[model samples]
Target chain A: MTPASSAKAPFQNKLLPLMLLLPQLLITLVFFYWPSVQAVQQSLYIEDPFGLSSEFAGLANFTALFKDARYVDAFLRSLFFSAAVAGISLSLSLLLAVCADRVVRGATAYKTLLLLPYAIAPALAGITWMFVVHPSIGIVGRAFIAMGIEWNYLLNGNQAMGLVIFAAAWKQISYNFIFFLAGLQSIPQSLMEAAAIDGAGPAKRFRDIVFPLLSPTAFFLLVVNIVYAFFETFGVIHAVTSGGPSKSTEILVYKVYSDGVVGLDIGGSAAQSVILMVIVIALTFVQFRYVERKVHY
Target chain B: MRSFIAALSLGTVLSVSALAAPVEIQWWHAMTGANNDRVNQIVEAFNASQADYKVVATFKSTDYTELMNQTIAAYRAGTAPHITQIFEVGTATMMSAKGAVKPVFELMAEAGEKFDPKSFLPAITGYYSTADGKMLSMPFNSSTAIFYYNKDVFAKAGLDPEKAPKTWPEAFDAAKKIRASGHPCGLTTAWVTWTQMENFSAWHNIPYGTKSNGFGGFDTEFKFNNPTVIKHFETLNDLQKDGTFKYGGRTTQPEGLFVSGECAMIATSSGFLGNLMRNAKFNFATAMLPYYPDVAGAPQNSIIGGATLWVMGGKKADEYKGVAKFFTHLSKLDVQVTNHQQTGFLPVTIAAYEETKKSGFYEKNPGRETPILQLQNKAPTENSMGVRFGNLPKIRDLIMDEVEAAFAGKISVKQAMDNAVANGNEELRRFERTAKN
Candidate 1:
C-alpha cells in the first residue's frame, strides 16, 4: 500500500488545510487539554468554594493527602477493586462468549440477550443489585435470613465492597462480551479444523489456535477494563454503598467527587484529579509497552 | 385625526405603567414533596398579599449537600439566587464568607421593618446568630431530634401506650420488653451522628467540641470522645449485643425500620413526623428525647436540625428590600403556625407557639407539642446552642465511618470515638487553613 502522507496531493493553499483542522483542534484544546492544565494549576493553590480568596500552597495538598491514612487506604483499596473487577469481568465475558460461540441454533438470541446489559446505566445497575441484595427487602436478603445467616451490607464492610464490585463488574461484562465474541468470530475456522484433524480436543484446540489469535483483542480489553474500573464505576459505588460502612468502598474517583464537589475542597480535589490523571496515563503506557509485547499479532 | 392622536398617547402611557412591574426575587431551596408544596403556598400567599414584589421559589436539588454545592457554584458564577435555604451544618461556611451574605437582622432594620429578634424562640435563633445576638439567617424550618414510638407495638408489648420513656435506661427496658413481645427489632435510630453525637452531647449539656462547638471560631477541635459519649456508646454496644438495638444504615434509613413495624422506637428528627403521619399504618406518638438521667444539668434543650433562609449578597437594593418584606411575611404568627402545623417543623417564634397552643391545635393533636416543649424547656447553654464548623458535613462523614466500624464490632466504642475525634480534628485543621485565606 502507498504511504497515505506521500499519496495525498500537496495543498495549494496552506490556510485551507489549517482551516480544515481548526474545529477538531479547538475541541481537543477546550475540552481536554485546557481543563487538564487548569486542574494542574489549581493543584498548587488552596481556594474556597466561592473563590473569594485563594492562596498558593505549593505541594502542601499532595503532602497532606499522603499523610492522610484514609486517602492511602482508598488508594490501595481502589487498586484491589480495579484488579478484581477487571479479572472477573474479563473471565466471565470470555466464558460466556465461548459458550455462545459454540451454539449453532438460536445464537443470535443468546448474543442479543448477553448484549442487553451494556445498555444499562451504571447507577441503575448498582441500584438493581442493591435492591436484590438489600438486607430487609431484597429477595436474596430474605433467603439469607431464612437460612440463618447474618447478612447486612450496611454494616458489613466486606459485603459492601463485594456488592459494589459485583455491580460494577456486572455492568462491564456485556462490553467485554461483545468485543470477545467479535474477536472469536473473526478467527478462521480452518485453523480449528486443522487442529481437530491433529487429534486435538476442544480445550487444546482453543489454547493452541483460537486463544493465541485473540490475544490482541484481550490486551486491548485489559486496558479498557482497568480504566473502566478505575473511573467509570463511581456511579455504581455512589448508588450501592456510597463508600460507606466505614469507607471500605470509597474509590479514588469517588473521593475526588466527594472532596471537590460535595465537600467543596477545590484545591484538594484538583490535586486528587491530577494524581488520578497521572495514574491513568502511566497505566495505559505500561499496558501498551509491556502487555502488548505478549500479543502474537 | 385628533381622536387617533389621543388613543396613541393613552396606549403609550399604559405601556409605561406596565414597564414598572413587580420585582421578581429568586428563592432556591431543597424541599421536596409536601414540604415543597408548603414552600409554594407561602410564596403564593406572600405574592398575593403584596404587589411590590413577587417571590419565585425553585427546587434546586433533592438534598442539602447537593443544594449547598449548587448554591456555591452559582455564587462563584455571579448568578446566585437572591435567597437560598441552607441546612444548619452549612451555617459556619455561610458566616465565614464575609461580604457574601447580608445579615437578616440588618436587612430588616435597613428595610424600615419593625424587626424584633427576641420575638423568635432563642433556642432556634441562637443557632443562626452571632456572638452579639445578631440573627444571620431567618429560621425557616427549624426542627429538633425527638422520640417516636409505635403505640400499637407498645400496647402489644404490655407497656403503657400513653407514656413514653423519659430516660435512656427506661428506654432500654422498654426495648427489652418490646423484644420479648416478639418484635423483629426492638429499637433503632436515624441520623446517628446528629441524634447520637451532636444532640446527644447537647442534651447532656456537654461540649461536642472546643470553642462552644466551633461557634466561637475556626480553631475549634472536636471533643466528642468525652466520658459521657463513651459511656453512651458502650451502652449502645451492649444493646447491639443482645439484639435490642438494630444497626440501621446511616442517616434517615433507620426511620424505615420503625415505619415498617419492625422496630418499636426511633429517635430521629422531628421533621420525620410528616412522613410518619403519612405512611405509617400503625398509631404512633412523639416524645422528648431520652437523656442519661444521671448527668448533672441533663435534659437540656435540643438543637435545631432543619434549614434556614439566608439572603445572598451582590443583589440590587430593591431585591434586598423584597427579601426583607418576604422575611417579615414569613415571620407572621399565622404563617409560622401554618408552616409548623402542616410540615411538623418547629415554630420559630414564641408568639407562634403560644398562638398555636391557644388555638387548641396541640390539644387536638396530643403529641404535636413535644418538639416545641423540648426546645423551650430550658435556656440553651453554650454547649447546647448549636454546632458550627466549616467542614461539619465532612466531619460528620468521618464520625459516621468510625461509628459504623464500632457498630460492626471491628473496633471498641472508646476506640471509635477516639478515631472520630482524631480524624475530625484533622478535617477542622484543614478547614481552618483554607478559611484563613
Candidate 2:
C-alpha cells in the first residue's frame, strides 16, 4: 500500500486514493486475514479431518510440534532449502541476465526461451525433471549409472533432496533473470562509457559498476526467491520426492500439506502453518532490517 | 391440424418424462485406467439390469488418500456422493466417523434387501465387520498380498518354474542363487510395508499391533518390533548388502521392476494381476507369501488389500433404495465372478468364489487363484485378521520411512522397527484424541 502523498500521482480530492485502494484492501482482508484467522482458530483445537469431532487443548498442538524431532528436522531442512534455492537462482539468473544484456541479435528469442520455464507449472517442472533423472529410465540417469554412480533417487535421501532443489531452482531462475535484465538495462550507458574511458576491463566494469547498481533488484529477488522456495515449491517436492527417503526433502510447507491434506492431522497441520507464517515473517523482517542496508538506490 | 398439433405435444411430453427416469446413484471411486473401465462396466451392467436404479460412477482420483480426503470434504459440505469406494487404509477412519457413512448392512436391512453375511467370504468380509460380525461396508474388490516371480527367471536360475519359495530362508536362498546366476536383482516388492511388514506379520501369525491389530479398541499399540518382523528386515538388509535384493521405494514403484524383469520376484497385491497381465512380457507366477518356518503357527492366512463400497450417510430414502439394489446386483454371483476374473480382485462372496472355481478358471489362468487360496488358507486368527487403525495412511508412511532408513543402512533393523512402533503409537494416540466418537 504505497501512499498517494507522492506528488507524481497526487489527487485533487483527498479521498480519491482511498476510494481507489478500497478494492485491493478488501481483497487483502478477505483472502489473507480470513484464512489466517481460521488457521489460528484451528491451531488451538484437535479437530477431525471430516469435521465429525473437535477438542480444545490450548497450546498443545504447538507444544507437540516442539517435542517432535521430525518437525525440528523439517524446519532446519526448509531453512537450508530456502537459502540454497535463493542463492543458486539469484546468482545464476544474474549471470544469465548479464550475458543476455550483451546480446545484439536474437535477444527476444533468448529471453523468451529463458522465461518459458516460468510459465510451466511447478508440478510439471518437477515431472519433466523426473523424466530426465529417473534412475532406471532417464537418459542422464542411465549415463550416471553407466559411469558407476548409483543413480536411484528413490532410495537415496541426498539424491532425492538434490533433485527437488534443482527442479525448484530451475523453475525460479527465469523470474529472477527477468528482473535482473531489467535492472541491467536501466543502468545508464554513460556509466559504462565512463568506466571504459577509465581503462576498466569488462570484468572490472561489471564487478565495480554493474553489480552495485543491480544490488537493489538482487535484494528484492532474494526475498521473493526465499519465500517462493519456502512456500511455493511444495508441488515440486510432492511430484518428485514426496518427503520420502527418510524425509530428507520434507520441508515445512510440504509437512503441513502432508499432515493437513494427506495425513488429516488438522490441528498439527494448522500449528505447522502458523509456525511457517511466523518464520517467514521473521525472516523477511530480518532481511529488510539488515540485508537492505547493502542495497543501492 | 389442431388434433395433429395436440398429438405432437403429447409425444414430446412422453419423451421428456422418459418412463419415470431411473434414480441416479452416484458412485465415487479411485479407480483409473483399466480399473476405471471395469468400474464403468459394472455400472453399465447394473444400469441395464433394472429400470428402477441407474448407478453413475465418477472417477474421483487414482490415489485413495486423496479420494478419502475429497469424500470427507464432500460429506462435510453435504454434497457427498451416495456411494464412495473406501480403501482398506481408510476403513478405520470411516468406522470411527460415526455419522459420515451409512453402514452397508444397516442400509441393506433397512431397504429390505436380502443380505446374507454368510454369503460373503469370511476372511474378506471379516475385516469390514464389527466385533459382533455385522458387516459395515460392502466388500467389492478385496485383494490380498501374494508372492510373484518370473518363472522364466526361475528356469534361468536352475530352479523349478512351478515352485515359488515358500519359506523366508528359502526365498532369500533362492534370491542369492538367482543373483549368483547373474541377475542384478533377484527380488523387489511393491507396497513395501503391505507386502513385507503388515501382511508379513499376518502371514507369520505374529501380532502387528495389540487389540487384534486395532480391531478391538483405539488403545492398541504396534508390536511390529518383535523378533519375527525384525529378522525379516535383517535378511532383507543382508540381501541388499550383496545386491541380491533391490529396494523399490514405496507402493507400486517396484511393480515396474518386476514387470520389466529387472527384478525376478515381487510380493504385491493380487490386484496387480491385471497390470501384470497387460505389462509383463515374461512368464510370471504367483504363490503364498513367504513365512518364517521356525515361528509357531507360521504361514497363517494373509489379509485383503483392495477396497469396499461405503454408503455415505445422508441421502434420500429412494436413493438408499437404489444403492441397495446396486449392492445386490454387485453381489450377484455372475457379476462378482466376472469382476474377480477380469480385475484379479478376490470375489467378496464365497458363492462367487465357488462359482469361479467350478468354472475351471484357475486351470486356464494359473496365478489368479493364488489370492483367494491364500485368503482362505486357514481361519483368520487375531494375528492374521488385518491391521486397522485410524490415520493408517500416516502410520504406513511413518513405517515405510523407517523401513527406508533401515534399507539405506542408516539405522539398524531393530531401531527402524522400534522407531516405527513408537511413532505409530503416537499417531494412533493422536487419532484417538481427535476422533472421540
Candidate 3:
C-alpha cells in the first residue's frame, strides 16, 4: 500500500491535525522543553534543595563557575574524554564489523556474540570491568602485580582516566558495530567486485571503495558516540573511578551531578547544566555545518 | 425497611474500622545487606509492639550520598518520607534546611514521649545538635574512626600481637617493620577524609574550622590546613614514598586490602567491624586512632561518623507521634545494645552503654568496646565536638581530591591542604548564601 501523503490529500479539518498531534506536543513541552526552560531559569537564582527560599543571583552562578579552576578543568576533560571514547569506539567497532561482515559461516552467531555487551547496563559494565582489573583481586590487576608493574588505578590519575575510557568505549562498541555492519552491508557489492576484477587487492578495494561509502554511518556514529561519552558515561565514571584520582576523570555531566544532585548546589549545578546544553548545541551545529559536508549522504 | 437498616449498620462498622486503622509512617534509609536486615527487624519489632502505628522502613540506596539525593528530590516534590536516615556528613545540610526538618527533640517533646537529651552520648549527639544544646536529629548507627591491625601479621613481623600502636611515630615504625617483613601493602585507610581529616582533627583536639567546627553558625571557615594537619599529611606522604603506606580508593574501597590480608594495618570506621567479622580469615583487632604524642591535648576524642535518623517536616501530627514512638523504641537499652553488638555501631544512650558493659558483652568481644571508650575517654572540646558545615559532602570531596593529589606525589602536603581549604571555603560561602536565613 502507498504511504499516506499529506501533500496529495491534505486534512479536511485543520483542527483535526492539531488534535492528532496534541499528545506528543504536550508531552514534549512538559517533559523536555519545560525542564530545559526551568534549568535556564534556575541558573539565574540560588536556592536550597527544599525550595524554602530563593535569591536572584543573576549571572553570579555562571561567573563563579567560569572563575573556578575545577569547572574549567572538567570542561576540557570532557572534550578529551568524548574524543577518545568516540574515536576508540568507532575505530574498534569498524574493525570488528568489517571482519564479521566478511564471514559467511556462522555469521549470526558471531554477530549475536558481539552484540552481547550492548545488553549490559552501563553501571554493570563498569562494575564488571572493575572486577576484571581491580588491583587487588582482578585477573589483569594480579597479572600486572605479578609483572611488578605496580598498577594501582586508585591513586594514579592517568590510570584512572584510562580505566574509565576503556570501560566507556567498551560499552559503546557494540552499538557502533551494529550500525557499521548495516552501513557496510548497504554498500553495492557490484562496486567492490568491479574494483576486485581490476586487480586491486582486498585492502586497496576497501580503502578506495568501502571506506568512502561508510562515511555517512561513521559521521552519524561520531555524533552519537560523542553525545554518549558526554552524558551517558557518567555512570561508568561514577561506578569505576567516582571521578577520583584527583578528579582526573570528572567530566561535565558527572560534575553537574556531583555538584548539583550529590552536593545539593542547585544553582551552581543548574548553571553547569545550562552551560553544557549550549556546548552540545554548538557542537551539533558545527558538525552539521562542517563535518556533514564530507559525508557522501 | 429492617434489612436496609441492618445493611447501613454493617456499612458503618466497616467505615469505622477503616478510619481507625493504624498510622503508617514511612522511613527511608541507606542501610543494605545484613545491616538492612537489622533495620527491618527493628521496624518489625516496633510494628508488633503497638497497634496505634505501623512503621514501614525502605532501603532506598546502597550509599549515603545517593540516599540523600533521593530524599532531597522527594522532599522537593512534596513526597518525602516521614523519617529519613541521613549520614553524618549531611548533618549540617539537614540542620540548615530549617523549616524542612522537625527536630527530633521537638518531635519527642511535642508527642510527650520520654526523650532526655542528657541520656545520649554527648560525643555522638553533639554533631547533630544546635549550639543551644537542642538535639536536631535522632542518633542512629553512629561510628568512629579506629585503628585496625592484623594480629597475625603483627606476629609474623615479630611485633606484639595483642598491642596496637597508640601514636603516629609508633604506627609508622610498625608500618616500616611490616613492609620489611614482606607485606605488600604495609598500611592503608578508607574514608580518607573522615578518618584522616575530620576525625583526625577532632581526635587531636585541633580546630577543623572556626565557630566551634561550624557547629555554632554558618560563618565558619575551614581551618584544617593548620600546621598540625599539614604535619600529619606530610608524615603520610613520607610513608607513601617509602612504600610504608598504600593509597586506597576513596570511601571504604581499601577495606578490601585489609580483608584480603594484603595490608597489615588500616585506619577506618568502626562500623566496618561487621564486614571484618564476616570476611577476614585472620585475627584482627582494633585500637584507638593514632595521634601525634607531642601535641598538647592530643587524642582527646574521636567524633561520630555513620548516620542519624531525622524527622521530616510537613508530615502529619499522627505520623510525628509514630516517629517519636519509633525513636523511643530504638533508644531502649536492649535494642541499642543489640544494634551496637550486631552492627558495630555505637550505643547512643548511656543506659545502653552501661547495660552492655554490665552484661560483659565487651569482655566477650575484645575490640568492640574500643569505639565506645574512645568516644567517652574525654569530654569533647569545642574543637573536638564535630565538624559541621553546610555543603560538607562537597567540601569533603574537594579535600579527598586534594589529598589524593598529595598522596600521588603530584603536589606537596602543604599545597594540598592549602588548596583544600581554599576550595572548601568557597563551597561553604556558597552554602551560606543559599542556606542562611
Candidates' interface RMSDs, in order? 1.2, 1.2, 1.1
Which prediction has more favorable TM-score, 2 or 3?
A: 3
- Second chain only: TM-score per model? 0.95, 0.94, 0.96
All candidates: CA RMSD (Å): 3.2, 4.3, 2.5
Q: Evaluate model 1 with DockQ and give the value.
A: 0.63
Supply the TM-score for candidate 3: 0.95
**Most accurate candidate by TM-score:** 3
Name the 10 consecutive residues with the lowest summed lDDT in model 1 chain B: B428-437
Each model's lDDT comes to 0.90, 0.88, 0.90
Q: Where does candidate 3 clash, by residue pair? A: none
What residue pairs clash in candidate 2, if any at all?
A: none
Error of 1 at B159 (Å): 2.1
Candidate 2 vs candidate 3: the DockQ winner is 3
Q: What does candidate 1's lDDT look like per residue over B199-287, in tens digits?
A: 89889999999998887889999898999999988888888766799888878889988889888999999888878877999998999
TM-score of 1: 0.94
TM-scores for all predictions: 0.94, 0.92, 0.95
On lDDT, who's better, 2 or 3?
A: 3
In model 2, where do residues sit more than 4 Å from their true spots?
A1-30, A281-296, B1-23, B48-52
